[model samples]
Target: MGRLYQVTVVGFKGERVTVDLCNTEEQMSSMTVEQLKTKVVAKLKINTELSRISLIFADERLDDDSKLLKDYGVQHMSVVQLVLQVDGGRQL
Candidate 1:
């Protein structure tokens, strides 16, 4: 079994959830950002597509879906911000 870490995911509307994640250095290093996004989507019950969302941590935006979380310095008890990408060119 891998080590478990506590994580808090906060949504744009201030909705937040605390979840326990089992992540190992090896596992996370091998996982890509897209995979992480999928995991977050499942945990947060997000209704939007993966392309319409982004994860932010420590005031930094996570953009590379091909990189590992460790590369982004994501650690235990980290708080990740979930933001919905909006197309400004589109009329509401």
Candidate 2:
């Protein structure tokens, strides 16, 4: 079975859209945040560039110096939050 992931995209309007990674593999393990952003862009067929969005990785590890990743190892069914904030004049 392929690894599954829950990606939540939060908009500026306080609306969230969750997409499921059903047929995805464990490729995220070997990819950086930038690489993963590219994948997400391609997967979602986003017209804008992937770098235009803010990608947040919340894993299962928390450090005193960093609050980015939590202490919950990301697994097959991990749920991640992606906040997509557009500029004031930027429109889809």
Candidate 3:
């Protein structure tokens, strides 16, 4: 038997998107931050570079793509906040 959990991706104005799922605990832990971000971008239907997307969980910023979800102790049904970073310099 395997463990399955959901990770919801939320954006501005309560834009909810449930796109991350793991077939097993091991798989979930092995999943990297970048992988989740990619899924979010696709599910959210946003055309932006991977670097432009920032993920936040438990009031902590997930800035390392190479790090696994387990590194942050992501729990079942974890709510990940998506922040779309603007590219280039300021518009001043």
lDDT tens digits by residue: candidate 3, 27-51: 7878999988888888888888998
Residue 64, model 2: lDDT of: 26
lDDT on C-alpha atoms for all candidate structures: 0.76, 0.47, 0.82
Instruction: Output the number of the lDDT-best candidate.
Output: 3
Q: Candidate 1 regions off by >4 Å? A: 89-92
TM-score of every prediction relative to native: 0.79, 0.44, 0.85
For residue 58, what is the lDDT in candidate 1?
84
Query: TM-score winner among the candidates?
Result: 3
Give the C-alpha miss distance for residue 33 in model 3, angstroms.
0.3
Better of 2 and 3 by TM-score: 3
lDDT of 2 by residue, 28-62 (tens): 34334454455556655666765465554463211
